[model samples]
Target: MKFTFRKYERINKQKEIDAVITGGRKFFENGLLVYILKTDRNYSRIAILVSSKVEKSAVIRNKFKRRIREIFRLNKYKIKTPVDIVVVATQISVRQKYKILEESFLKILNQNGILNL
Candidate 1:
């Protein structure tokens, strides 16, 4: 598959904030807490937030975001809805592996009833 979450799927509306924050369920793991909210669309969007306090280097922070994006891209087939997903990385994730991140992410999707299998 072509691993990508396409630009069109990105959520940038102000109205989505509440659903992303309050309505979304939290999925905790060593690296981050993933908050996923279901949207009434045909595709999904992803937002990643990494606190400056977690990593001092901009390059490192960007890398984390890229990794998260890749994870979502590669696993898009497992997801079934056009949900809005926000990934907030904790300090622990800075030192973790990509596989671990993917596992944690998939676990959250399953917990939130967003996965297909």
Candidate 2:
């Protein structure tokens, strides 16, 4: 399986983001709020949301986004089912390291049966 977070593998449209954030199943743990919507599409897509509450600086916010995206990008191919995922970083995420965030993210998905791995 290909492991890449390409442009097409990103949820960029406002409508798509809203749909995933509002209509998907919600899971929260370790400073991450994840919304996952199962889809028929063969490929999965994702979006990372880091609000001002998480960080005041754009650099920090982007850093968080990149970390979350990397976690998703590396393990996305392991997802048994295709899903549109929206990951929102809570205030605490700004203080969490990438390893902690990744572990929490994967654990949540695995525990909820959203991800095969």
lDDT of 1 by residue, 50-107 (tens): 8899989898889988888998888887788878888887889866788888888888
**Backbone clash count for every predicted candidate, in the order shown:** 1, 0
Please list the C-alpha lDDT of all candidates, in the order they appear.
Answer: 0.81, 0.87
Worst 10-residue stretch by lDDT in candidate 2?
Answer: 108-117
Looking at model 1, report the run of 10 residues with the lowest lDDT sum.
Answer: 9-18
The TM-score measured for candidate 1 stands at 0.87
The clash tally of candidate 2 reads: 0
lDDT for each residue of candidate 2 in 44-113, tens digit (9 for 90 to 100): 8998888887688898899888898899989987788889989888888867899999999898789768
lDDT of 1: 0.81
- Stretches off by above 4 angstroms in model 2 are none
Question: What TM-scores do the predictions have?
Answer: 0.87, 0.93
